[model samples]
Target: MTDLPLHELAIERHIAAPVSHVYKIWMERLPEWWAPKPWTTEVVEMDARPGGRSAMNMVSPDGEVSPVEGVFLEIAPEQRIVFTDAFRAGWIPHPPFMTGIFAFAPDGEGTAYRAAARHWDEATMQSHSEMGFEAGWGAVADQFKALCEETWVAR
Candidate 1:
């Protein structure tokens, strides 16, 4: 199990799918389950490698778009992914809210998926928590689990 730092928030789920399938689905279909219901995600570009750029826009129901730009710090296929908004591609500095860490491991015939958000300070973590982090991340997890399980089972 990954240690939970003081400035971090995380959620975990056990999905009825293999780790490889879960990881592949997440990388290949990120825009589908990245956002909660009533809000959709659009992947502008994603280079799934260390130091690669990861960009996306989340569109609200009312058409408000929130763009996110980050760089991948690490990508261990079927194991883990780490990214941060602290910098853009080519190491350009940017205002960062948090660093994202996602891990996937095999649990029998399923996968143990963990998603974590690491903030720069406790205040930032608190702000994220107060912004419905639990509900939002939980909903996204459910969406992802359902998609991975359904897709894997159907194949």
Candidate 2:
């Protein structure tokens, strides 16, 4: 059998907005389009720095809530961001999960955005895939694009 990568799902899209704008929304406007609406999201704490915390709650329509808490391993303004749920703030170890890297680069007048998820093993990768990684992350990306373009057009 072939070897499975330790990394999991990754998605990319070309968003018709500036790199800075795309980066800004990921942090500042996250809650607006974080979850596929009907299910909304809320930010609890986001210091947005290396070793800083990133916490949010995603609430379903029926009031079920799921919290995502993690730390920013790296933050390159308007360029890239790396965070992981494997550890909480202050470098405290938690249950090992997924690490994510979000990046934006100028593509023509817009930006090329990428969200890549890394897992510790094949099992974790498979679990995230089965959890609708594509559909869910894709939806949020679309929502983010619309929100950014709409706001840009309005300005």
Candidate 3:
């Protein structure tokens, strides 16, 4: 079994868009500019309700596909979202299990978005951190913010 430790990684950024618009971009149109490294997600199923399933197939650059399935623990439109990786669609708990929380708040003329990912344990956190979690997520967040801003302007 993979080691499970308690750990947290929080990233916050100010997106130049209204909270509602930013949230829509995140949940409704994420596939657009989600990542530039050739990763795509086909949301197999999404209920967006507590105890409901949210599953997606992530296609890698090399044409390999992997499924990332989880459950939505909480969701507040334009405000917050929480999900857990404790149970996948068809698999049991695996290594580095995590719970992710995303929060959005009004910041001046924009939205302050924060994402906190809590892993099962310190070892798992260390492993993910070493695997470039900061850089990878940072890049995605940057891209997301840019897209949101562009969309906001076009609106």
Which candidate's lDDT is highest? 1
Over all chains combined, what TM-score does candidate 1 have? 0.95
lDDT of 3 by residue, 1-155 (tens): 86654499877899989999999898887666555456876778877877778787777888788877788889999999998888764445544368889899999999999988898778888887888888877877888899899999998
Clashes of each: 0, 0, 4
Q: 1-155, model 2: which lDDT tens digit per residue?
A: 86766576988989888998888878788889989988999899998889999999999999999999999999999999999998888889999789999989999999999988999988888899899999999998889889878877777
- 1 or 2, greater by TM-score: 1
Q: Per-residue alpha-carbon lDDT of model 1 for 33-119, expressed as tens digits?
A: 999988999999899999999999999999999998999999999999999999999999998899999999999999999999999
> Would you list the C-alpha lDDT of every candidate in the order shown?
0.96, 0.90, 0.81
Q: Considering TM-score, which of the candidate structures 2 and 3 is the better prediction for this target?
A: 2
Which stretches of model 3 miss by more than 4 angstroms? 1-6, 89-96
- TM agreement with the true structure for every prediction: 0.95, 0.94, 0.87
Best by TM-score: 1
Ranking by lDDT: 1, 2, 3
For model 3 the local lDDT of residue 29 reads 76
Alpha-carbon runs more than 4 Å astray in model 2: 1-6
